[model samples]
Target: MKIFNVFPETIFSIGPVHITDTVITTWLVMIAIITISYFATRKLSVKPSFFQEIIEAVFEAIEVTIKDILPVEPWLVIPVLGTLWILIGFSNLAGLIPGLKTPTADLNTTFAFALISFSMTHVIGIATQGLKGYLMHYKEPTWLLLPFHLIAEVTRTIALAVRLFGNMLSGDMITIILLGIVGLLVPVPFSLLHIIIALIQAYIFGVLTLVFIAGGIRTKS
Candidate 1:
């Protein structure tokens, strides 16, 4: 009856070492991304095939979204945003597999992903507008407001990580509970709903990343 038992965990570890089901899943997710992307981009075609077409459509959509959000340099944002969308989108959908759990279902995994985005956001900001300019922006309107701006950034990153982790973990929990009570057939509707939730979470994460990056790149008036 304990659903948690199915998740593997290492008994003990040496210095700087920790292991868990989530770690295994994270590695799998990275490998999956590398494998898919390598093959997807391995051969460029003048006349695209089905896989290439799908990849192109996804990139095109990301490009358009970036253009809408950051008018000045859509090209600059495309690679980052596009890669995030694809990687997160694939990781989210990975839960649908019978034996695999989505990495997003684990708080550690989601937080790590969110932290990377958060760091990149600031790094991009500093790169776009030098350290002095970037730091000065927080004092805009009034120096007293700097603390509030800093708090907002931290709160936003925590919110992003928790939102994704909560949604995916809840979906997985719900599916397991329903399956226990009524077996697989009854869980079909819930699974379908989970699929929708997964896609939405990925889209939301991607859009938020785009917005943060765009804001960072914008100049103060």
Candidate 2:
């Protein structure tokens, strides 16, 4: 293992685009999600299996998170938010696998997520409130705040990306260092803690996305 390798190792090159280990891991995670989802819901009956119950509980939790942020139709946004949670949660937990790196530890993945949320915020804003009303949100309270609002929008997205990258990278690095120092078994507690933190970070990312979208949809009264 390459100890303390901050950058993702390039596995191969397709044309000019280099495919990294992180990308490979992300693809595996997506496939796993799809497989699990298909199997879990494939035999859905009125009497839910334990696995199906767990899946439903997760969806319920995500729905509650969305409803907490916006009173709007939570079902309409569940697919987006639910996918975000699954992707992020899986990415964050990838560190548990010996050879797999967490995609969330890479800026490319987090920034992509942030960019999607940023686009969704404005898109939903324009759809819910007319384009004119959506644009007017920047000038809420006073037009003087337009520049600040615009700057905040871009900066916050960057912040969101960096926040996930930094946290996941730091957590993984620490776990690796501890394991190296005292061996793997000694770091088991830290690994558990990392799992908790990873889930929390995923939840935060999803909630922030929902909140940003909600803000965009609500125009000045």
Candidate 3:
């Protein structure tokens, strides 16, 4: 087994863009999600099949969770939240396959996800509340807190990236070590635990994104 601590090995390069195994695995995960999604929604009926029912149940659960957090205009961000959840879910699970590492185990992938969430939070905030209002929010309670608030914005973004990366990397490492030490079948419980952890990480990441967006739009009373 190839043991990579953090950085993924580069498989090849397309001109300036170096494609790593993580990138290939990530693309495969994306393809899997897209293909599954396409077929799942291809046929529609008033009465649903087993497959359709499963899909609908998943969607309903996600929608309910988003609504519980955002409450208002939940539908507006469903696409983003749903996509993030699926992508992260698949990326985390990809590590289970031999010769394929989980993308989330790499800092690059987690940082990219965090950066996107950070950008969207500000964009949504500015769009919902004017630029002046968004800026003024930092000065709330006292003008002295503005610097701390500004620092927080940057720190939280970094924290998001580091938190996911650390959790995913550590989980993958533990699983790999256990599998190596113990025979495969003996480590089945750890494998299952890893799967559960992957789902929880994805859920946490998605919920946090929703929270950031909601915070952006919430008006100071």
Off by over 4 Å in 2: 1-4
lDDT of 1 at 144: 94
Candidate number with greatest lDDT:
2
TM-score of each: 0.88, 0.95, 0.93
| Tens-place lDDT digits, model 3, residues 73-100 | 7777788778888899989888878778
The lDDT per prediction is 0.76, 0.86, 0.83
Write model 1 residue lDDT over 63-138, tens digit each, in one string.
8877787635676567776777776777777777766667777777778778878987777677767788777777
Better of 1 and 2 by lDDT: 2
Q: Candidate 1: minimum summed lDDT over ten consecutive residues — where?
A: 1-10
Error of 3 at 47 (Å): 1.4
What is the number of backbone collisions in each predicted candidate, taken in the order shown?
A: 0, 0, 0
Instruction: Work out candidate 3's RMSD over C-alphas.
Output: 1.7
Candidate 2: residue 57 Cα off by (Å): 0.2
Kindly indicate the candidate among 2 and 3 with the higher lDDT: 2
The best candidate in terms of TM-score: 2
Name the weakest run of 10 consecutive residues (lDDT summed) in model 2.
Answer: 1-10
